[model samples]
Target: MSAQDRLVGAATLKRLRLARGWSLADLARAVSTKAKELGQPLDASVASVQRSVARWESSKGPILPGDRYQLLLAHVYARSAHGQLALSVGSDFSELLYALGHLGESERRLNDLRTLLVRTATDGGSGLLALLGPSTQRVLADALADPSKLDEELLEAMGIAIRDVNRQVGSLPFVRVQLMLTPIVESCRRLLDGTVPDAVLLHLRAVAAQAYTLAGRAAFETRDDEASRALYAAAAGGVGPPWRRAVVHMSHALVTLYSTPGIEAAQQLVDAAVRDARAGESVMVRARAHALQAEIAARAGSARHAKAALALAWYDIDSDCDGDPSPASFSAAHLRGFEGLTELYVGDPSKAHDYFAQSAEALHTPRERVQHAIVSTDQALARIRLNDPEAATELLHGCVDAASATGGRVAAIRLRRARAYLRPWRREDWFADFDDHLIESFGA
Candidate 1:
């Protein structure tokens, strides 16, 4: 069947009406009244309008409303769903129809969908380059048909898109970043299906590897460690530079560290990442790899080893000239956070608090919400260790606020850690408040 013959629009309209507990006749009357108020009076009587509404919401005769009727219908539900969909979708009737069908009765989903559409429109489909508009679709179609058309410029553009999405992983909402990265990763997979010419094969693989690595990060942000591991493995299989391989190895190690009980396996992966970094002469990668190594050592309660790794990490970071790329990039603040964790693990609450404070101060405002939340929770844990449950609870509330908006799994994990540390004071009023807020924001 043709696209126009689909019952998607009809089903959307019916669901929207039913969700409000409104009948066809009620919707018709509402639309008629709204149209007159909006200075576009419907000439049809209420009975006629009701019949039209029924037909509009019918599958047998799936006909879209005219522009005037659409406007009238939107205005009728202006305070609710349809009107908001119209405003967000603008004059693109097809998009409006598709969004209506896609979102169903979830206002939250509608808002998310609106943000995605607006970002796609304003950002020139930067993250969604694979699903670009007609012109780009045409170009991609030609490239897919004949591999030579996947030129260097296009490959570079794809690389930039991958980097852009990678940068959004920590800053943007997890769901939004996941949504943006999925398509790029899928597109890269298709490109790497053995069709590209030998001239650009390695370059294409490099870009594809970057895409997979970033997607792995997105999955990790959502706490989907299994998927994250698979994506990182796919990235490692692709032919890329030594630095890129280091990034993939480090990413895989991170997921393994958190998700599995295989500490030795995680250590081996991070060790490989460190070697790759040294081979590539990337001090930045070395810094990040060592930071991960320090964390692993700290988690294993090897205070001496952890401190040694942190010292090496600090030295590498100081000597680093060029910064790392988005997917596996490390900043001074990140190193400090790792230092804070190491100090806490080593039974130095005061030192951990000092490191976390420095990290918090160094973080970029508004853009580092997730990182800030994680740091706050870690600092709170330090406060708990210092016999200050009230201060820890206060910090946890702030973490809850941050996670409520961004749905950051990293922040949630830190919050869980803080909660565990506060278990001794769980019966206290402040602890109750913190625990209740955590459950409400994240879950039990």
Candidate 2:
């Protein structure tokens, strides 16, 4: 470590605040917001914020408030100075460094993706996208200063790879896709800073958005809620068409739902999705969207609306599910699982139990697939409500391996909830055994 390393924590905070032209008060407010999200409401009074900001920036106060705080801080600074940020807070957040480090990995990914494309890209990476039509070279941009022109084909190839990659994310390793695409997204953003053809520029923007979206999906599946939200927001900026924009909004809503329990915020996202979908006119998008809408409506104390939206979702499921669904389309099993979830949220665990059981029966005839882990956990939740605690325990034990493999954090959340439900019976032998299993599947 160098001399500057000693001062990293305070200096880093000061620098970031300055870069954003934020005062001590402004920094305090942002910190307060982060704190609120973590369920620690800050005073936010000018006096409280100013003093806290001073102490934090000077290292005179707690540099890291808590593990969750540090993780949230890492997320807030995820896009800029991520290396320095990581080094500064390294001691405070060793377990969470992987989340922050991925930010830097995006920059390095550009070269790696280029090499990969040159060697073995199937279609999207085939020549990295070489498409030419009706006099596009002549329809140039006034934005171009004619510097060393970059390869449009290569950039287009990167974009195609991003869109194509989303199809496989459901089956492939989420971590691998996140690592591969984020860097390409960053490279696309860097390229956009330079002059390129208007057509190429627009194409680059769209691809970057999609890359961010795909990367966000990976982050979400991995249970990195805050990072997923930020990535989705970045993706939302470059959305061009109505259908894509609708998907972006819907995706943003999905992340928001996962991150917070605030019904108002969830409603806002649903409304945004609805507004964007009007132009797209796809029953498929609307269908998938209603599944979310059902969840939000259930959470909002409107069982009638939840049921209505879920019915619409069922109607739309087959509209575009005939072998060639869009990247965001829901399968019959997914819709059924949501139907079960809506029942769970709408105060009917018996119906929820039946829905989840039916869905699981259809989806899990072979073996407990990784993708079904969350659904299985949902089934377990319904069992908890059904007073079949032993059955709930058995289901969780069966699904733990697959659930942890797919999304450990979500699995942990479900397990944690199960543990809480079983708390009153902790004295029982079987309950004690189930408690140990929860500890094993998740952690204490």
What is the clash count for each candidate, in the order shown?
0, 1
lDDT for each candidate structure: 0.72, 0.61
Q: What is the C-alpha lDDT profile of model 1 across 152-200, one tens digit per residue?
A: 7667756755655554544467767777677667767777774777888
TM-score of 2: 0.61
Candidate 2 per-residue lDDT over residues 1-444, each given as its tens digit:
233432455566666667767788876676677667658775557568667556656644324333343444544443233322221112222222332232222323322322322223222332212111112222222122341364566555455555545533333446655655655656656666776656566676777788788777778877787888888888888877766777887777766666677767767878777666655656677677788788889878789999998888777775654443254455677777888888898868988888788777767421235446668888988988888888887887766666555454455666777778877778888888877766675566
RMSD of each: 12.9, 19.2
For each candidate, give its TM-score against the true structure: 0.69, 0.61
> Which residue runs of candidate 1 sit more than 4 Å off their true CA positions?
1-134, 320-328, 365-367
* Candidate 2 global CA lDDT score: 0.61
